[model samples]
Target: MPTILVADDDANIRELVCLFLRNDGFDTVEAKDGKEALTVYTSVHIDLVVLDIMMPNMDGWALCKELRKRSPDLPLLMLTARGETWEKVKGFELGTDDYLTKPFDPLELTVRVKSLLKRYKMAFTQTIQFGSITLDRKTYKVLCGANSLVLPLKEFELLYKLSGTPGQVFTREQLIDQIWGMDYAGDDRTIDVHIKRLRERFVGTPDFCIETVRGLGYRLEIMS
Candidate 1:
């Protein structure tokens, strides 16, 4: 199930959003302010974040900026009553993936969340192959020729991201954005950990290498 973080000062707004998300089969964690939101986000694994512009302590923009610094590709949905062009631009500039005005339709919010989840989930699949190893994106199964390799969720996502593009080199930011979704609330350390795990899994496979580009990022080396 997808996890969502809803940050709003109003009790009613938080409840309403939580209800809608729950009905849509999403698990949510709620926060009343930006500080609380950041706390919840850092601790829990959230797929997306719904941030309100006006809030005490941190505010949406500041929090969004912090999130972007850690995970540039993290998915964030900015919520505000302003609805002005500049406010929207600021959110976008701060790395919010989407935006919604206050008093938004519950159905529309549901649809947006569903869409984001679908797009993010597509990054990981149960069936993928990098050289001799084959990954089942759905079942999280990894097969190396006749041998099957076990992978955790993070490892699976990393391999899936790399395998999808074949030889394409993806920056750590790109990988974090693709696999962890936008509102990841995690840092580059998250990407490093997953990459380490993935490399160890394919260590014996001389053909498949997750190449490090120094300052660029990592990529699956495709041998011809």
Candidate 2:
């Protein structure tokens, strides 16, 4: 599960969001204000952060800047009642990845979280590792602790391509072109079948797992 830090002053809002996000299969950490948010952020390997604009002690705009400086590639989402165009432009200028107006739909928030993860992955690159499992992009082998597992041609290439940017959601069409040739006569379910076998061989990795983005595609999420 992807871990998100949710910062808001309103007790009810923070609790409600954590409840809904947990129900959506995401792991969430809560903060009551900007300072607390920063503290939580520095202490954890947070995948995404949600900040409310009008909080006490540092507000979302300032917090956004702080977080951006910490990790230029970190994904930040701002939530506030201010829906004005100027406020949004200001948030974007400060490096927020997405902004949502208050009284926002819980479902929409979840969707935004996934979208930000996808966007951040596109903009960044790093070795994908979780626990003792490492997806070596160059060799197309999963290094599990002291051992290595070599995958089939399709599975190796597919996992290697995804490892190029972990957390990136790849649609079936894109995967087909990357693995089997675009001219290959196959359905999307063919991708699913291969994914099933890949997961079976990917052993000893409870923290690293492939996630099916509902109504979209697949993304490999490595939890810290």
Candidate 3:
């Protein structure tokens, strides 16, 4: 069973969330503050975390950053009273996989937790296959039917990241930080350029396509 760390200042909310998660077949660890949450996280093998933004000792933003630094792929879901667009954007920038405003339904939270876990599992695999295409992260190769093609390092990493979590929209900033590193002092449009190249290269292929999500960033969609 996957272990979930529920960190919130409110004991009632923590208990309620953990109760629902436990009822749905997940083991949970609870912490009333971000400091305790971090300590619990380091000591326990937590598969995912549900955290609130405002807390004593340490806030969710700081905790999120610390956790992301420690475990790049660890799934984080933020629960907060603030539903502002900037808050959501900041959460994503800090490496949160999902966000839910306060007063949310427990059932909705459970569903989101399962979705995040599923996405995390898919991303943890070294190789991912959709239709006729196979992305081998170990060798950095794209195997489509009889052909084995190599992409540029950046392009390959971008594709691998997107394909790892199909339908998950990743902002250009997230892509740059994850793929190009935080110190990458370049224009974000580089992501667009790389996406274009990947699309042109795989245009005739029916396996998947990289989609631009208008105001958002991009997501990989597998062709049916």
Could you tally the backbone clashes for each prediction? Answer: 11, 0, 0
Per-model TM-score versus the true fold = 0.55, 0.56, 0.89
lDDT digits (tens) for residues 160-187 of candidate 1 = 7776655445666666766787678878
Give the top-scoring candidate (TM-score).
3
Candidate 1 wrong stretches, greater than 4 Å: 122-224
lDDT of 3 by residue, 7-70 (tens): 9999999999999999999999999999999999989999999999999999999999999999
lDDT of 2 by residue, 11-122 (tens): 9998888988899898999998999999998898899998999989989999998998788778888997978866766776576766789899988998888888875675
RMSD of each predicted structure: 10.8, 11.6, 2.1
Candidate whose lDDT is highest = 3
Against the reference, the lDDT scores of all candidates come to 0.77, 0.80, 0.91
Cα misplacement distance, residue 48 of candidate 2 (Å): 0.4
- Give the number of colliding residue pairs in candidate 2: 0
Q: How many backbone clashes does candidate 3 have?
A: 0
Candidate 1 vs candidate 2: the TM-score winner is 2
